[model samples]
Target chain A: MRKGIPNDPGRRDRLRAVALEFIAERGLRRFTVRGVAERAGVSPGSITYYFTDTDELIMSAFELLTEHAEPNFNVRLRAAGTRDEAIEVLIDYVIDPDDASQQEVRAVRELYSLGSRDPKAAALVRDRLEANARTALMLHFTEPCAHALDALIEGLWTQRSWNDEPLDPGMVRTAIHGLVTAFDSLEGTSA
Target chain B: MRKGIPNDPGRRDRLRAVALEFIAERGLRRFTVRGVAERAGVSPGSITYYFTDTDELIMSAFELLTEHAEPNFNVRLRAAGTRDEAIEVLIDYVIDPDDASQQEVRAVRELYSLGSRDPKAAALVRDRLEANARTALMLHFTEPCAHALDALIEGLWTQRSWNDEPLDPGMVRTAIHGLVTAFDSLEGTSA
Candidate 1:
């Protein structure tokens, strides 16, 4: 372990963070171990010694991203005791992401674009989707409604990411509220 | 003027179509006039005659994409006589896109990703967003509801594009209904 270049745990973590940032800055297809090594000011060999392959490297970066997000999700979601609060949680965590960076959302979207072609990347996206749906269900949303919320979060995120301006919270609240009401009506009819 | 290798209007249209397909297949960062020429079986000089610069080529491709989409939107939207019919049109045209191919969606997303850094691209995206919202409003959705519908369409498109399986139409209907209901209640409250 030579300062920031070798197989230290901290160095390994730093490489993963750098890899994700690189993908976020430049699109996923531009991601290369050598590129990440250059950005991190370490030799390619030093980085490869820790990651071995680019796929492993990208996967690790994704793991780190989820690991960082998981706790934030848990804390906020755990605090929500009502449907209204649950909507706030979904908006903050997913659509608007007041606590998350645009880079993080971009990185995840690049991974999602990859999912259209790569099976492993697809599995990760599916896992995230399932987890989101499960989160909504835990908040007492019906199955279809939970998926709807998840989809809305994803759709809004895309819209928000592309535009330079922040979405009005008032509008986001109304949209989410609309979805909930629509589903509530459906549930009422089916029941 | 020589078959498919000159400044002919037919060849120009073909080049634009090829450029969009190339971006959809290989992503926007990898797009090159030469690459599109190769894909179109034309020479780079021939392409330059129609589009002197890559920016023009890309913008032209974006224009062609909209030209193709606009008629579909107009025809379908014009036929929708009721709220439920409007929902069905939206689902078919935006969410599930029964008539549109996945390639079209991917190409649009590539342009949207480009919007984050490029001002021209950003304008195009904003235009598309505005147009979608306008369509929703014309369906008698209130202002906030129209925006919400646009966001849901965008969000659902993102979800549907990334996944291999088609989203269940029944589930999609429920989600859209939910948002509309929520907004309807708000409108009623205000009235």
Candidate 2:
């Protein structure tokens, strides 16, 4: 077997990173393969060589953002001493104004807009979101509570997207506490 | 005061309805003031005479759609046999495929995408959403529970926008049930 090109993986990752930044800055409506290539100091053909089209580049960039965030989020959740701490970590990550990943929030919103018309994009987003929800649920709660918790977390994220005011951390914590208690009581009954 | 212009109000309503249909079919990306005027069977100058710009047209169409849906929703909710019945009515309205007003759902999602970059659109969506939330809370639950329920309902609508599989009516009922029960429990504790 021929050895893989030594720097090929690095180049591919660099291209995706640049594309993500472009998506964040200009939005998917304005994102172009040539733009990404130019910003990455690469040829336009290289983008085409790596990604089938702009849609693929965008979908890949979205997948990469989630993949990057997942491990860190899981670690934070696992390390939290209390449910309140876990909820706080989630809210802080979600609503932080300084984070570059916040741009992904807007990007995902744009993707959803496109997805309404494009079935392929819709499928890509739906599949990834369901997978993310399932993974998050499995990580955080038992089977009985996982579905409801997923719904609650998803609701929180959606609210953050639309609400102009910064979320009150205390209110979020109170909701989380209520959810946890509700789930615990639910578990006792089902058991 | 000048006597009301006969047919003037009817002409404006017809123009707004046509604008809604055109925008829904072609999307805001391809929408043009001239195109809307042509479809509405009015002169381009007439369109401009009524609305200053494309943004004004879009904002007006959105307002028209919201106003049309609001009263019907309120009437249905008020007529429900019980609180549970009201929740069911709300859920059915939100997820109903047969409802023509569902186009409003699509329009709202588009407005959200626009809101990310356009402060005016963002403010419009936020103000309307918050006002609706406040009104619903005042009618359905105590202040705190209303706030929480508003977030939940808004989150559910956003999720519905991207979901590929048709929402199960039963699942929707479960979510509403959980939220209502949680609020009722909270209210009891406070009492």
What TM-scores result for chain A when each predicted structure is judged separately against the true chain A? 0.83, 0.75
i-RMS for every candidate (Å) is: 2.3, 3.0
Question: What does the lDDT read for residue A55 in candidate 1?
Answer: 83
lDDT of 1 by residue, B81-123 (tens): 8877877777776544553467766777676666655678777
> Per-model C-alpha lDDT, please?
0.73, 0.65
lDDT for each residue of candidate 1 in A83-117, tens digit (9 for 90 to 100): 77877787676544553467767677677666655
lDDT of each residue in A6-105, candidate 2, tens digit only: 3476677778888877866666656789999889988998777777888788777766655664455566767777756766766665446444445666
Q: Spell out the clash pairs found in candidate 1.
A: A155-B155, A178-B178, A178-B179, A178-B182, A179-B178, A179-B179, A182-B178, A183-B178
TM-score of each: 0.84, 0.76
DockQ of 1: 0.49
lDDT for B55 in candidate 1 is 83
Name the top TM-score candidate: 1
Please compute DockQ, using alpha carbons, for every candidate against the native two-chain complex: 0.49, 0.32
lDDT of 1 at A45: 88
Regions of candidate 2 where Cα sits further than 4 Å from its true position = A1-15, A30-57, A63-66, A69-75, A78-98, A142-144, A162-164, B1-15, B33-50, B69-72, B80-85, B91-102, B164-171, B184-191
